[model samples]
Target: MNSFWAVFKRELKSYFTTPLAYVFLVIFLFFSGYLTFKEGFYEARQADLKPFFVNLPLLFVFMVPSTAMRLWAEERKVGSVELLFTLPITIVQAVLAKFFAAWLFLGIALALTFPLVVTVCYLGNPDIGLIVTGYLGAFLMAGGFLAIGCFFSALSKNQVIAFVLSVVACAVLVFAGMPTTLNYVSTFLPPGMVAAVEGMSFQVHFDSMQRGILQFQDLAYFVLLIAGWVAACAIVLDERKAS
Candidate 1:
């Protein structure tokens, strides 16, 4: 626990000490708002953040990876991974601490968009329950993406390679949940297989939560997905240590 906190504090502080955190926040906030108002038709739509929520998964495809690309990549790049291993903490603890730090930073960035909630409430009566659920889904989805990013970051010594690989990997998951992707798959695959693929989509689970329907299965999918990737990260670290 002590070692976890130590790494958490160091990694979280590292985000702010450099320009990365600020740049990411600014870019995210700007694009989120732009997409919501311009593409989302915020003025024309009813008192709902549906458009914002709709765009979030796509935004996360790029943004979360950018934030996570440095987790272990930078450590290896500068040879600080050796120092990290020298600590009393186990590899799993370090992995969780770093993952949580990045995840929490994403939470902070998401929370900063609260003014959107405020604006929607001020405009008219909105389903507060639905809005809250949407944010919850977004946060969970971000964690899932971050976990994938962390896995790839641990695998690569170059940050750019980590970012690119994370983006590609996350993009597949994101697109898999889309109706278009599923439709394309259905043309080639049988109905049963198509349904299975659709069920595996991050967007499918996220869309359910976005609608204020918090199914246990949807929640479990994100939890298990994150756990799986984090475990993979630990394995990669172990292999590197062995090598």
Candidate 2:
């Protein structure tokens, strides 16, 4: 436990010291502001944050991989992964600590967008419940994507490859419930199987919660997704250590 906490704190603090964190944050804020302004013009809805939340999955699809790509890939590239392996912690503990650190970064990014909420409230009587739910959906999806990103990060020592792999995985998940994907799969699979795949999409379940409907299934899906991927990362790391 001590080792886990140590790793978590160290990783978290390392981000702020490096220029990477500041650069990414600046770019993220720029895009967030741009999207918000664009959404405002197109929707012409004063009190709704529909545009901001609508672009969340897209924003995270790229932002998250940037963070995760460096987690293991950079460490391995510079041969620091060996130093980490020499510690007292197990691979699972390290994986969880690293994952939580990345998730916390995303959480802070989401929190910094509070001005959007204030803007909506100042303009009209917007539903805070929906706003809360939208942020919740965004945060959960970020964690889930980070897990997926972490898996790719462990696959190689090349940060570029890691980033590209995570992006591809995220893209598939983001579009999992889209009509095109489902329609294509519907031709080859049974109706029930196709429906099940659609249900498994992050967007399908996220939409319900983003609209202020807190469903247990959506919550469980994210929890399970994160757990599954983190566990996979640990197993991979352990296998390499043993070999």
lDDT of each: 0.92, 0.86
Top model by lDDT, which number? Answer: 1
* Model 2 regions lying over 4 Å from their true place: 40-42, 241-243
What is the overall TM-score of model 2 with all chains considered together? Answer: 0.94
lDDT of 1 at 2: 99
lDDT of 2 by residue, 1-243 (tens): 499899999999999999988888888878886887874543686587888887788888899999999888777778778888887888888888999988999898888888888888888989888998988998999999999999888877788998999999998988988889999999899999988888878888788887899999999999999999888888776665333
Over the full model, what C-alpha lDDT does candidate 2 score relative to the true structure?
Answer: 0.86
Q: List, in order, the clash count of every candidate structure.
A: 0, 0
Every model's TM-score: 0.97, 0.94
lDDT of 1 by residue, 108-153 (tens): 9999999888888888888999999999999999999999999999
Off by over 4 Å in 1: 241-243
Candidate whose TM-score is highest: 1
Global Cα RMSD, each model: 1.2, 1.7
lDDT for 157 (candidate 1): 85
